[model samples]
Target: MTSPTDPAARQLLAQGRLEVEGRLVDASNVTLYCALELDGLSGHAVYKPVSGERPLWDFPHGTLAGREVATYLLSEASGLGSVPPTALREGPLGVGMVQLWVDTTDDELVDVRPPAEVPDGWRVVLHAHDRLGEPAVLTHADHPGVRDLAILDIIANNTDRKGGHVLAGTDGRVYGVDHGICLHSEPKLRTVLWGWIGEPLPSDAVEKLRALPEKIYGSLGEELSAHLNGVEIGAVVERAEKLLSTGVFPEPGDDWRAIPWPLF
Candidate 1:
C-alpha cells in the first residue's frame, strides 16, 4: 500500500522537522537527517531517509519511488541486509513523519554509523576500516551469507557495495546495507562476493527466490512500478528467475566486473 502516489507520504513530509544548531536540515529532495527513538531499542539514532531521487540514481527509480519495496526485498533475504526502520507516526520530533530510526547495534545490521558525531556541525566522508588496515577486505570464502549477498546484489543490479557497506556483527553474522544503488535497468552490479565462486545455491534459498517474482509483482512490485519503468521492474524479476534456474552466478555482463589486473 505504500506507493509513490500515497497521500499520507506528503502529509508526513510536510510536518516532520528536525534541527541541527538551529538550522533545519533540508527535506526538499526527500532526504532528511533526523533523530528517532523506538520502543525496546537500545538508543536514539540519526537517520537519513532516501525517497527515490537523483543522488541515489546509482539505482534509478530507486531512492525516489521503490524504497519501501527494496526494504521488503531485503527483509525477505535470509539474514542479508537491514530491515526497514519502523515508520514513526508520532514522536518527540512532531507528527506525520516517515522516518526509520537507526538504533540497532546488532552486528547483523550494516555499519551505517554517521561520520564521527560533532557538536551539531559536522561534515566528512566516513572511511571504512577493520583491524588489519584502511581498505578492509573479507578473506574467508566459505561464508554462506556472503555468497547469498553476492547473488542478491547481482539480481538487484547494485553498483555501490562499498567495503563499509558490509557489516560484521558480534554475533558472527554479516549484513549488507545502502542499497540505494540497486535495481538498475542497466547492468551496474559491482560487489566482492566472489568468495564462493562455484558453490551451488542452497535449495531452500532458491525456493524462496523463485517465489519472489510473483510476490513482488503482486503488491510490492505494483508499489515499486509507480516509481520505475516496467522494463526495469521486469529486469529485476527476470534476474531473479535466472538465479532460481541456474543456482549459480550467471555470466557477468556488466562493465563493473573485471577490475584491472595487478600491475606488479
Candidate 2:
C-alpha cells in the first residue's frame, strides 16, 4: 500500500525517523526491516546498508544499494511503475538503499507446477522436469503490471529477476523488488519473464520507450549519474532503442543462461 509518488509518502521516506524492527536472514546482504514515521505518517521499510553487502565477483563492490535506487529511478521514468519506491540514504548501519515495504497478497504470480496444471490465462515460460523427474512448467500470470515489469527488466538489464522478486501487493499493484544487481553496461539479462517472447510490445510500453529519451536527458540522466557511469547509462538508452526497434519482446541469447538458477 506504500504510494511513494504521493507527496506525503515522498516526504515521509526522505525525512522520516527510522527504527530497526528486524532482519531478513535469508538475504545475501544485510537486509533490515524498519518502521518509519514522520508527522504521524508511518509505514514499514527495508534497509540494506552498503557496509553489509557481500562482495560479488561480477559486480563492483559496495555499489549494489546504489544500483537498487537507480533501477527504481528508471522504472519510474519508464512509466513502468512496477518497482516500489526506493531511495538511497543513511540508515542505522550506514548509507544504503531504503525502500517502502509492500504489503503483499497470497496471490502466487509465478510458480513451477506440473505442465498440465498450469493455470488458465497464465503464460508458460519453460517446460522442464523437477528434482523428482516430474514434468514441470515455469508459469506466470498474464497481468499488465507483470508485463510492465518485463519491459522494465529489459531496459534495466536486470541480471537477476527471480520469481521471488515479483510481488503481488494487497493494494492490487504488482511490484518487482530486490534490484541490487541491475543496470549493468554488459549484457547479463537473467529473468523468469520470457513468457511473452517474440510478441509485440504493448502499446503503453512503446509509448514509454518513445518518451524515454526526453526524460533521460533531463532529471533522470542527472540522477542516474550518481550511480552509473556514462557508458552504463548510455547502454540503457541503447537497450531501449533496440527493444523499440524490434517492437517485440526479446528472445534469450545463447551467450548466457537465460533463466536464473533456482528460478524461485
Candidate 3:
C-alpha cells in the first residue's frame, strides 16, 4: 500500500474516519487495526481507546492514549521522527489514540541468535538459552537510527521498551511504538537498547536534547498538559535537562528492573 505524505498522514490522523479493520490479537491492550480516510486520503492506522486500557497501579487510569500522543509529540520535538504520526481523536469506540501503521514486511529482527552465528556490528545486550537449550544472544544493530531511538526513549522515560515495540519501517527507517507507559515522574526506564549505555552521546543526539526545552515549553507542552499531570510533564523536562548535561547514554540503575518481560 502507498503510504501518504507526512502532512497528509497527520491531517488524516487529526481528522479521519477510523474504520476498524480488525483487532490485533498480539497486543496486551485493546488495539484495533484500522483504516483512516479523510478528504480522499486513505491509510492504515492503529487505534487504542482509553476505555479499553487495563488499569496500571503506577500510571493513572485511562491516560494511555494521551501518553501515546505525547510520545509522538516528543518524537517531533526532538526531530528524531522515529514515531509514526499520531493524534488523540474520537473514534467509533470513543476517544482514543490513532497512529499511522508502519509497513514492516521488509523488516528484520534486531538480533536473536548465538554469538558465534551473529553478524558483525551487532551489539549483544545479554546471553540466554533458547527453547532448544542452545545459547542465544539478544542484540541490536549498531546503527544511527537505533541510537536515535534509544535517545528518544530516554527523553520520554519509557517504561516498556520491548523489542517488538521497535519496528523497522519498509522505508528503511526505525519506528518505535506502544508508548502508553511513558513520561512518568519516577524513573521507570526498561528496554533492550542498552548496547550504547555509557557511550558518549552522538553530537546530533546531544543537539536534539538541548533543543527539547523550547519544544516542551511551546505547543508540545500545552498539548501534553491536557493529557498528562503536572508531575509527568515536569519529569519530561527534567529528563531532557539531565540527558543534556550528562552527554552520554545512561546506565540502568540498580533500583529498578532494567529489561522488560517477554523480551520479544
All candidates: CA RMSD in angstroms? 10.4, 1.3, 1.5
The model with the greater TM-score, 1 or 3, is 3
Q: Sort all candidates by lDDT, best to worst.
A: 2, 3, 1
TM-score of each: 0.59, 0.97, 0.95
Clashing pairs in 1: 12-96, 51-63, 51-64, 52-63, 52-64, 53-63, 53-64, 107-169, 216-221
Ranking by TM-score: 2, 3, 1
Could you give candidate 2's per-residue lDDT for residues 29-143 as a string of tens digits? 8999999898878988999999998878888733999999999999987887578788898889989888999888899999999988888999999999989999999999999
Candidate 1 vs 2: which has more lDDT: 2
Output the number of the TM-score-best candidate: 2
| Top-lDDT structure, candidate number | 2
Give me the displacement of residue 152 in model 3, in angstroms.
Answer: 0.6
lDDT of 3 at 10: 84
lDDT of 1 by residue, 1-264 (tens): 122223443333333443322212342233444532223222222233342134642444434324444543444532333333324233333322243323223332222232342223221122455445435323323456555666677677776665445555434545555555567777766654444444577776687687777776687677566556788878877877877777776655555652211100
Per-residue error for 31 in candidate 1, Å, reads 7.9
Over 88-143, each residue of candidate 3 has an lDDT whose tens digit, in order, gives: 99998999999999987555547588879877888888899999999999998787
Model 3 pairs whose backbones collide: none
lDDT of 3 at 249: 88
